[model samples]
Target: MLNTQHYPQMISPSLMGEWIVIASEQEFVQRQQIKTCLDGQTLTLHRDTINGVHVYQVNFESLDMKELNLSVQAAYGFVWLCIGSEKKPLFQLQEYDVEGARRVPCGAYGVRTSPLRGIENFLDMAHFPYVHTGILGAEPETTVKPYKVEWREDVDEIWATECFFTQPLAAPSSPQPQETEYVYRVASPLNAILYKVNTAAEGIIPADVVCLFIQPLSETHIRAHLLMILDDQTSSMTDMVLFQQKIFTQDKPILENHVPLKLPLEKLEIPTKADALATAYRKWLITKNWCYGVHKNTQEEQVV
Candidate 1:
């Protein structure tokens, strides 16, 4: 049986594949509250009744919301408003977009294969050890293989891939001793992930966390919002900020020049086994009935 339990409910750092709907009823609501308009109307947002007020609504169905179990009062984080079939939003949820003056994780970490700027591919599990050499070097032998996984479809759905790593230095090979832990969770709407890699023992603890957000600035440009909580057990804000800035700066020149899949389909069509995750994403997108290569009303596209 296919495990539907692996899917996630919120768009944060642990889940993937989701729908984010936004809508407004009248133009007056837009003028009254100018603080909440993100990406402008590029996002299909409208106004709806909330406690008698025609408030903006954003609905997001993703795997990331799993880690964001905040009180309704905390309305600063990037919010997801759910729009019902009537093209009306049911409620408004919030998230803080900027932290420490850096753009928070908005979505996708697409990299290029060569300077010819020709062949492009989304970084998948296979490249983890190769691309991120220092932290996650290529280790075909030590790769974590999925064993018991699960999937689900609920208010907070999830698609989890659980496995254990077999390291050579400190533990046994069989049954896999749990050393460092890594999980890529996606909540919804945004095309980013919450990355958590942790290693802790007795009294020593280490954790590296990030809310990596990628936003399409325009048809050709993009931005990366890096909200990193690295070495929570040892580093302070001062130490972490500069370190992250350096990393971003190193990637900025290359990441900024990276090409997007904006050209006509025929212009860029290269596929391989490495595109498995992207293929899955495209398939899931088709299920959402998104307007491919054209524009259409999203509310008319939802299955329900």
Candidate 2:
């Protein structure tokens, strides 16, 4: 009587109510339909010549693709969908508006890990030396200097500032190994932004921004999309995209190997001082009662 198979699993309301990224705008070319999933829900995307992009979910009785009839919009080079009945506003990025900023979109990798884990990894500074070695950091400069993290109640987001790290190559425009300053912003449960001070021309130029947007295909699986708003006048777009792809390839294996798959929020191991932003992210999720792509240390938990 019902097409229960349409939605393979029950998605958390918190996640459903949010505008989740389905794919980069570039993926939807002409009238081609892009089939994808979000939080275990199957989706089909269509774009026509006259009308814009349209999203659909399987119908109940007929078991055919039907209009999702939810909030669908495009911004920052990505197509966003909110399946919940009442839609929440999508997050913003002012840096995207800067004039002459080179926009680079890099990734749609099917990562075998929780979206939460990916975000936490992006927020970590201590792993730079070992994980992203030579590019983001290297040995002898492995210190994660003191930083401040704050939970902005008004914005319902987390911000980490005053963070510093030594790097072999901070950005594509970096002349050589140098010190770098970072500001991380958790824009939503599934999106984050990294702001690196424009070392090429500090006060005069705006900080380059790298954004991470995750599409939760399941509790333990996700697709990560990246967009960069950069002010580098020297590096070519291909060079910047390749540089980011290299960093991502380095991180992919590490992220996939995380035990338990989903982040264990309740039984988390003791964190080091360098994990301030990571710890804060978990706490923020807990405050919001987030349950998607997270483990609560229960006995019945599935480790797969």
Candidate 3:
């Protein structure tokens, strides 16, 4: 049986419940069988597309098999599977005002790192110039300007705005270097969305949305699922996927090698002005009492 006390922050009750990305819509359609190991249990998810309707069945090793009547819907080109109470509200992608926004399915990457590490990396803008190099950021323009972080009590979400960065290739459809404006939202502990200026597209829309949802298989194992809703009219889906993949490929090694796999809620090794958002994120996790992937300090009181 799964222990709720030891469950990762990604599956904490304060954030609702566990929602995992089993496969992408294309992968489900092509393979028909999706296999995942959750909490040391292997789950075989089978799909049957009949009359254009997708049906799913899950089989657990040495356990009762069941067919799920839930309809499979593609949200921004990815298929998500939730394993929790039916009463919990599901995570929804933010609606953009841009018409004809193209959805791209960036591939899922398996990483040997904590889910929190994946998100912490995404939230950090200071490392872009060093980690992503000229693609996402360049040298001599490494200043991370002050940004505002607010906790929306009404929605119980964290929002960060007024972020700006210079990028050589901000978008796959654009070749010119430009200053990219960014806004980030932490919808849940394991889910985050970034909105950035789409310089390559012609539209009244203010920005495009890129979402990263982390699935925590264990304290040190995770799969990063990426999706983008962009206003770009020039780039093919394949090109867009490759571009995002390249950026993530550059980050994978750094994330995997990060010491202290679990996140530290206090006493950070390095501190900077850009870490305001990350600081707020750690406090939010503490408030929720979610500590499965957090480093424990023997001197501090146990979080239960």
Clashes of each: 71, 0, 0
- Identify the leading candidate in terms of TM-score: 2
Candidate 2 lDDT over residue span 1-304, tens digit each = 2233464444556675688888787886554667787766666776554455444332222223243345677788888877545334788887676667778898688899988998999899999999998989888888899899999988788999999899889988889887889999998989999999867844433688899999888878889999888888788889999989999889999999988678877746788899889999999998888878887675544532
**Candidate 3 per-residue lDDT over residues 1-304, each given as its tens digit:** 2344554432344323445555566777558887876544566778787898776666666433232223233455555555544323446665443468787768789888877888988899999899988888999989898999999877677899999988888988776999999999987778899989877777745688888888666667788988888888878888988989998999999988877766888785566788999988888888878765676666442221
Which has the better TM-score: candidate 1, or candidate 2?
Answer: 2
1-304 in candidate 1: lDDT tens per residue?
A: 2122453321222111222321112223345332222221233333445787444533222223333331111122333332112122222212223232222222223322121111122223444344444333336544535433222334221223343333322111112323444444433324334333444321222324455443322223333434544334344456556545544455545544433323222314464554443344444434444332211333221110
Q: Distance (Å) between predicted and true CA of 75, model 3?
A: 3.3
Model 2 misplaced regions, further than 4 Å: 1-10, 49-69, 85-87, 201-205, 300-304
Q: Could you give me the TM-score of model 1 versus the true structure? A: 0.45
Worst 10 residues of 1 by lDDT: 113-122
RMSD of each: 13.0, 3.9, 4.5
TM-score of 3: 0.85
